[model samples]
Target: MSGRILIVDDDPVQRRLLEEAVTRFGYSSRVVENGVEALQVLRAPEGGDIDLVILDLVMPELDGYAVLEKMRGDGNSTPVIVQTAQAGIDTVVGAMRAGAQDFVVKPIGPERLEVSIRNVLKVSALEDEIVRFRKSAAGTLTFSDIITRSPSMERVIRLGERAASSHIPILIEGESGVGKELIARAIQGQSDRAAKPFVTVNCGAIPENLVESILFGHEKGAFTGAVDKHVGKFQEAHGGTLFLDEVGELPLDVQVKLLRALQEGEIDPVGARRPQKIDFRLISATNRRLMDLVKEGRFREDLYYRLNVFPIWIPPLRDRLEDIPELTRHFLARFAAEEHKSKVSTVAPETVALLQSYDWPGNIRQLENAVFRAVVLCDDTCLRPDDFPQVQANCASRGAGGGQGGEPRIDAPLIAGEPAIRPDDAAGERSGEHAGAAALWKAQGSFAGFTDGSVPFGFLRALDRNGHVQTLECVERDMIVTAIDHYGGRMAEVARRLGIGRSTLYRKLKDYGLEASNGQDAAE
Candidate 1:
C-alpha cells in the first residue's frame, strides 16, 4: 500500500535523511525546512492526502508542537509521529496530550520508525472508516424512553444523548438494578449507529474458562469443544456497539486481551493465524469501583484509564425516589397487562407512600419485581397496602428502628428458630462485597413466612384499615380470598402467592368459610 509522508525539520541534513527513509519505505514524501512551511503545505486542500507526518520538535518559525496543536485544534486528526532527540517520559506524554499519535527519539531506528508509522496509520484508517460508515441521521429511540420526573434522570438522558453522537467508549457506573444496561441501550439507540448491532455480554455470568473464546472467538478444533468456527464479540459488533456489563468481574487475563483489542482496534481469535480489524464503539458497566480493583492490583491500571474515557454514573433508586411514582405506574401498566391482571392498573396513594418509605436496597429492579408481585397479588382495580405486605413491613421496621440483613422487617423479629431465607439466598446470589451491595431481583414469597406459623409481614394491619384498624385474621383471611380471586380459584397459584401449601390453602378456605366462594364447596 503506497501513501504520502510529510517530513518537517529545520536541519537540511535531517530533513533529507527523513525524506529518504520515508521514500525507501515505499511512500511518496514531502520535505520542508521548518514547521511553518510544513503547516502551509499541510493546510492546502491537497494536504488531506498526507497519510503520516514525521515532525521534529525544535524547528524554527513554529515548532512541531505548535503545528500539532493547531492541526488538532482545527479538528485535523491526521496521524503524526513526533521525532525528538529527547524522548523523556514527559515529552512523550505531552506530545500525546497535544494529539500526536506517537513519538520517536533522535537518530531513529528504521524498524522502530516504520512500526510506529504503521500502527498510527492503521488506527487512523480504522477511524476514517468509522467516520465514513457513520450514519447521517440519529435514530428515533433517543433518550425519550428513560421515564423520569426527577432532574437527575433528565440530566442523565441529556448527557446520554450527547454521548450517542460520537464513537467514544463509555463507562457506566451504578449499583445493581439501577438500569446501567438500559442507559447503555438508550445511548446506542439514540446514536447514528443505532441500526447496527448492540451486542451485550455479562462478564460475571460467563465461566472463567470460556471468557477468552467468548470475547475473541475460536477457530474450529482450537479447543476440546471447538467443533465449529465461531466469531467473537468484537468481530460480531463490527460497525456497531459492544456492551460489557459487570465488567469488573473480567479475569485479569481476559482484561489484558480486552485492553489490546480496544487499543489496537483488532482481535486475534483463538488459533487464528492473524488478527482481524474491527470497528465498534464500546460501553462498559460495573457496579463496583474499578479504580479500587486497580489499586488492589486485580485490574490493569492502563486498561482502567482506557475504559474510563467517558464516565456516566447512574444514581441508585434510593437517591431518586421522586421518580418512583412514574416508574411504578409504568411498570404497573406494563406488568398488569403482561401478567393478565388488567384490572390492577393504578397504584393507590398509600401504597406509593409505603414504597417511598423503605430504603429500596435492591434498587429499581427490586422495585420492579415488587410491583410485578403486587400486580399478581392484586384482584382489585387499584393496588392497596394488602397487595404489598413486605413493603409495609419494611416501612414499619424502618420506622421503628433499622435492622440487620434484608427485608420482611416489621414491629418484631421472627422467632429465634424459624426457617427463613435471606432475600439474596432465595435468588441464589451471594452478597457482593466487592460489588458495592449489588442486589438482584428477589421473587416475592421466595423467602416464605416463618416456620412457626406466621403470615408474611404480619404487621400490615397496624398501618392499613377500612376506616379502622383491622385484626390480623381479617388481613390474613382477606389475602387468601384475593389470591383465590386473582388466580381464578387455582389452589396452586393461590398457595404459592400466600406462601402456604395447597392443603394449607384448603384449610384456610374452610377456616375462612370461603370454600364455596372460590369453587371448592364440592371438595369441602
Candidate 2:
C-alpha cells in the first residue's frame, strides 16, 4: 500500500502543504510547480514508480486536463486525483473522462484526501491483480510478469528464457511455496506453444490407482470406476505444455509410464489398444530432490535424466531479503483492496524491518499469509510492529536459537507471542498467495541488524533508543542527512527536493550540525 505521490500545483504554499500532509500520512511525495514539470517527472524513466498524482487544474503551460489527456493518449495508466478550486460538475466529469481516477476540490480536508488516495490505490492494485490473473489463467503469462529484484532470480529467469526457446524438458526444483509451478507456467507462456492448453497435474495429490487414468486418457469401461470416457491431463495439454507438479511423489509404477511418454512423445491409456502420440512440452516440478528420490529407488533414473535436461533451482525466500519490501507492498495493496480495508494502505518501516528479520520456514507463502492477516486485522492507515505479533515472536524465538521449549530468559518490552487467531484466518493464509508471493524470497545471507545504519533505502530509524517514536526534529535531521547522501552533497538539489529555499536549507543544515560533514556541496 505504500506509494510515492506526485503533487503538481502552481502555488508553493499548496505544494508544501500537500507534501507535508502526504508525509504525515506515511507516504513519500514529490512536488512540481506546474503541469509541465509534472509531465517531465511522469515521463522520466523513474516516473513509472510514482503511484499517484495530485494535479491542479489551473497551471500556466500544460494544464491538468491536458496532462491527463496526454497521459491516457500515451497509455500511461498511472492513477490521478485531479484537484481544482472549482467544484463544478463539468470539471469532475471532464477529469473523469480524461482518465483521472478521482477528483478533489481545493482546500480538501486531510481526512477526505487520505480516503481518496487509499480508495484510488486500492482500486488500481485490484485492477492490476485481476488482469495478471486473467492472463495467467489464459496461458499467456510471461516472464515479464514475474516480479523479482534478486540477482539469483535473474539467473533463474535467464535460464528459463533459454529453455523456453526450444522444446527441452525442464525440471524446476524448489521448496514448497517457492513458485516452482509459476516458473513452469512462465516457460510455457514464452515458448512456441504459448496460448495452448497449459494443463496441470498434481501427481502427489491423486490416488495411486487412478494416476495412469488421470494422466493418460481412459476409454469407457477401461476400469471399474471408468464408467465414461475421459480425456487425461496429457491429452488435454496436447500441442501445449503439461506441468506435472510434485513429480517426485508419483508412484513408482506410474514413473515407468511417464518415462515412456517423455521418451517416445506418446502415452498408453489404462486400457487403450494403441499408444497415442502427443505433441506437447513437458515441464515438471518437485519440492524434493529428484536425485535423492532416484537414489532411493523411488523415482526412475531415465525419467530423472529426461526431466533434468534444463534445471532451474529457485532460492528460498529467506535468501532474497531485498525483495521483501516490494513483495510486501504488492500484497498489501492487493489484499487491502480485496478485503475492503480502505484505511490500511502502508506499513511502517519497523514493521518491514521486523518482517525482514524473521526466517520464513514456509518461504514466500508464509510471508504472504502474514501480510494478508496484518492487512485484514489492521485498523489504521499504516501497519506498525504491533500489528505483527506472531512474526515478532517467531523472529525473537529464532534469534534466540530455539523454540518454545528453550530455557527462556526475561526480556524487556514483553509481547504475547501468540496472537488470537480467527476461524476465518484459514482462507487468507493459503499457499495460493504463492502466485503473487512470486516476488517474496529469502535473504541472501545471515540475518543483519536493521539498526546497524546499513538498512536499505536510507530509512531513518523509526524508534529512538528508548523504543518510542522518534521526535520530528530528530527525524527531520536524519532525512536531511539521507537526502544529502542520496543527492551526492548537491545542496541546491537537496533544497529543491526537500521543498525549501537555500536560506532555510542552510539554516537547518547548521542547526542539525550537518554542515561540516556536507562541506563539499556539489552545487553550493
Candidate 3:
C-alpha cells in the first residue's frame, strides 16, 4: 500500500495513467520507457527501494518475460505484475512461468490493479516471514536475521560473529526487550552447533528453591516432588548451547554451583553419586550489571569474572533511531499476515516520524506489539499516526512536561465507545470519550502476552474477576471465540490465520459448543 512502484511501458499515455493511478492509491511510482531502463534501475544499488514492477509484456526489445528471466538470474526476487493488451491464457502462463507474481491485461481498471498490488505485496511479506521462521527453527539463524541499518548494531554484530567463531563464554548486556536472546540464538546458530538444540532458561523466572535442581538435574526421590528423574537444562543442552537469560538473577547458592560447573566442565545432580561432564557452550545475558551486583555482594565475584570473559553490550533502541523504519515495516508485515489484515500494508511517513521521536524504553518488543495492535485496529490500507494513540499521547504529554521513563499515558480512549480514566484521576472518574486512554505500563503480570501492556478492550484476560489465574482451556476457548467474532466467522480464513487445521478448528468449535453460531461454515 505504501511502496515505490516501477512502471515499465513504451506508451507515454499508458505510463502516465499508471503513474497517476499508483500515486492516487498511496504509492510512489517510477516510470521507465522500456525494459532496458527498467533493468538498469533495478540493478542499481538504489533499486532496492523498488518494491514491485509493473512491466509491459509486449515491449520493443526486452519483453516482460525476458526481463523476468534476467531479474531471476541475477537473484532478484522483487515481485512483478506483467501487463499486456493480449488477454490470452498462453500469455498469462508464459509470464507466470518466467517469474511474474501476477498478470494483468492492459487498460486495467483501477480497482483490479490495486487489488493485484496488495495481494502481491502481502504474499511477499508472508513468504519472507516463513523463510525467517524456518531458519530460526532449524537453528540456521545468523546475524543476517537481525534487522538493523545502524552502525552501532553493526559493531555489535561484528563482536557477535567473533564470539561465534570460538567456544568462548559470552555475556550479552542489554536492556530488557533489546533482543538479548535473539543475539544469543544467532551466536549459537553461527557456531559449529548450528543444527543442535539451543536451550534457553530464564534465570529470573525460576523459583529460588528449584534453581539448583533445574540447572543441575535431579534423580528420582531427590526431593518431595521429585517422583521422576529429570534432566536439567545444562544436560538438555548437552552438545549445543545453554543460554542463561537474566543470568544476574541466579541465586548466590546457584552461582557457586554454576561457577564450579563452568570451571570443572561437570555438574553433580541432586542425589547423584558422581559428577556428569557437560560438553555444551555457554552464552549468558543480563539486563543488570553483574559487576554492580558483585560489588553489592549479591553476585559471586569469581563467577562474574568467569561469565564476563567476552562481554558484548547491545545499545538500546533509542540510541539507534535509524533502525525504527525498517523494524516497523518488518513487524507490520508479520502481524498483518497473522491477523489476516491484508489491507494493512505500510506505515505512514508521519507514523514513522512519531515512532522515531519517542524513545522505545521497551525496545524492539514494544515496537512489535504496537504494530500488532495497529494492524488489528486499522480499517484502511495503511497505518497512520492516529493508529498509535498511546505513542501520540506520550509525545503530546512530553511536550507539556509530563510522563517520562517509557510509561504510556493515553489522553483518550484508543477506540470509540470505551470507558477510560487517567491514572491520577479519582476512582469514580470513568467517563465517555473525553476520559483518558488506557494508561498501561511495562509489567510482567497479567499482560505477559504483550510487552507494553495487556490487550486493549479486554480482548483477552489472564485472570478472572476473582483474581485467580484462568484455566488454559478457558483462555484458549475465549481466544478462539474472540478470533471468530473478530474475523466474522470466516472459518477457513480463521483457521489458516490461527495456524490450525480445519479439522482441529472444528473439534475445538464442537468442544466449546459454538458450532451452531456458524452452522453453514461448520457443515463445510
**Candidate achieving the largest lDDT:** 3
lDDT of 2 by residue, 1-524 (tens): 35789999999999998999998777779998988888889899778778899999989888999999988887789999999999999989999999999999989999999888877877777777787788799888888777667779989999999999999998898877788888888898888888899999987667667788889879999978789998899999998999998787677788888889888989998778999999989999877778876887767898899889989999988798866876887788888877988678777877878887865756788788888989878988888887777777655754775332121223322223322212111112222222221111112011323423333332245456566666899868866776665555666546545654345677898887776765734344
Worst 10-residue stretch by lDDT in candidate 3?
425-434
Q: What is the alpha-carbon lDDT of model 3 when measured against the actual structure?
A: 0.79
lDDT of 1 by residue, 455-506 (tens): 4432222223234455778767755654444344555435544544354566
Q: For every model shown, what is its TM-score relative to the native structure?
A: 0.53, 0.70, 0.71
Cα lDDT tens digits, model 3, 83-180, are 99999999899999999999999789999998898778768767777887887888878997777778899899999999999999999998777989
Better structure of 2 and 3 per TM-score: 3
Q: Tell me which residue pairs clash in candidate 3.
A: none
Q: Worst ten-residue run, lDDT, model 1?
A: 434-443
Model 3 residue 470 lDDT score: 78
Candidate 1, residue 453: lDDT: 32
Stretches of candidate 2 off by over 4 Å are: 10-13, 31-45, 147-162, 223-225, 329-346, 379-382, 399-524
The RMSD (Cα, Å) of candidate 1 is 23.9
Q: Residue 178 in model 3: shift from native, Å?
A: 1.8
